[model samples]
Target: MLMLPAMARSSCERVIVSADPAYPPLHWYDGKQLRGASIVIITRILTDLGLPYELRYLGPWKRVLYAAKNGNIDVITTLKITPERRSFLIFSELVLNNPVAAFVKKDRPPPFSKWDDLIGLRGGIARGNRFGSVFDEFMDERLNVREADNLETAFNMLLANRFEYVITGYHVGQAYIASANIDDKLIALQPFLIDSQNLFGFAAQSPCIAYLPAINKQLEKLHKEGFIERALAQARADWRKTPIIGKN
Candidate 1:
């Protein structure tokens, strides 16, 4: 079993959680409120613990990270655990594996079967999305990738040939394609970039860090009972039912 550090003794009045507004089936803003598996799981954990909490939609993914880093947000419901993020956030145990994929236009798939195949080709990713440390480093050193403000823009850009591909979370990418009715234009390349783990991150300076131990324990219980998988499926179905929130 993975052991978390000793629990903090500070008093936490409330836990404010947020996530990338574009990452559906994990977390996203559905026109008005945040919805998806990550939000469902985290909120359930907090409720069971009897913790007072508020789920905020702070806007873009970049601003959400900024708020968490500065302790303006108490928790990021789901995100890749990155070394840079460790500076100000204490992460919970690995919640689940999330695959990162390269989305290319169907009629113009790039020469991509390996990581090196992507070098020298132009790609785009939503701002604030990271695959894993190794892939991120490789992308920075050799890839010509643009960071769009959101996934919708990245996919539209891919369609417009602004770039050859859009690298993003596989499920969320699928959600966007489906919601926008653009599945005919784009498809994810085989063999994902990386299978990254999704985790809950608490602002290191926030009193909410005190609940890390309980959160991890509840997460373990949920995982063991298969609640996480069920939640993910339900979220995907729910997303399909909700009206598409923004322009395609």
Candidate 2:
């Protein structure tokens, strides 16, 4: 862990990176603080770039986006820029473009494909997630949708069979499923819907507009050096454990 002296806190201000407590591998509240791959990567970028930044706790997506758009907050992590968001904040070059998938308890239902596949399958989604324009627009009436205030709640709901399906970035789904040790309970299904990878970067057009390009430079540098991959590999290694389910 890194630490700064007491005097440094008053002398220099770390730009605030606003985070909502969802979207694992990007931003979420760990037991101690905001953490996940994107959080770690952003921290690494700032340290490597010699920039000072702090993670700010934002309650939900709406308030955080409001703060970001108004420049009340300096940055936001892992935003998928639509035209509306583009107007409010500048966007950095994407860090990781991860695929999204439908996850459900294995054996309960057949797989889903196409937009209408969600019919009759009560789907739980993290509120305010950008699942691409096509799916985003369709999420309203096309699917029987249940919104969870947070990822853990969504998973808990799914675990209880409250919803037939839940969707998330593929790797995050895998990590959480592993964390729950619920191999028989939840399985990431086939025909991953939606395209374009979920990318992490500084909020571009917002208050941090002047700062993102530099972070992008650092991200590119990290990519070239394979530092990002190495970092993620080390992170996953730290959390490896036997499945909490199915072993018995």
**Residue-pair clashes per candidate, as listed?**
0, 11
Q: What is candidate 1's CA lDDT for residue 185?
A: 87
The most accurate candidate by TM-score is: 1
Scanning candidate 1 in windows of ten residues, the lowest lDDT window is 2-11
lDDT of 2 by residue, 1-248 (tens): 75432222332356777665555544565444666667787888888878787787766678877776655566677666565776666667766666778888787856566767778887897776667766777776587888887566787898798988887777667777666677677887777876555444334433345556688899889889887777665544433442121100
TM-score of each: 0.91, 0.79
Full-model lDDT, candidate 2:
0.67
Candidate lDDT scores, in order, read 0.85, 0.67
TM-score of 1: 0.91
TM-score of candidate 2 versus the correct structure, residues matched by position: 0.79
Q: Residue 237 of model 2: what lDDT?
A: 45
> Residues 81-156, candidate 1, lDDT per residue (tens digit)?
7789988889999777789999999998977789898888889998878887899999999999989987888888
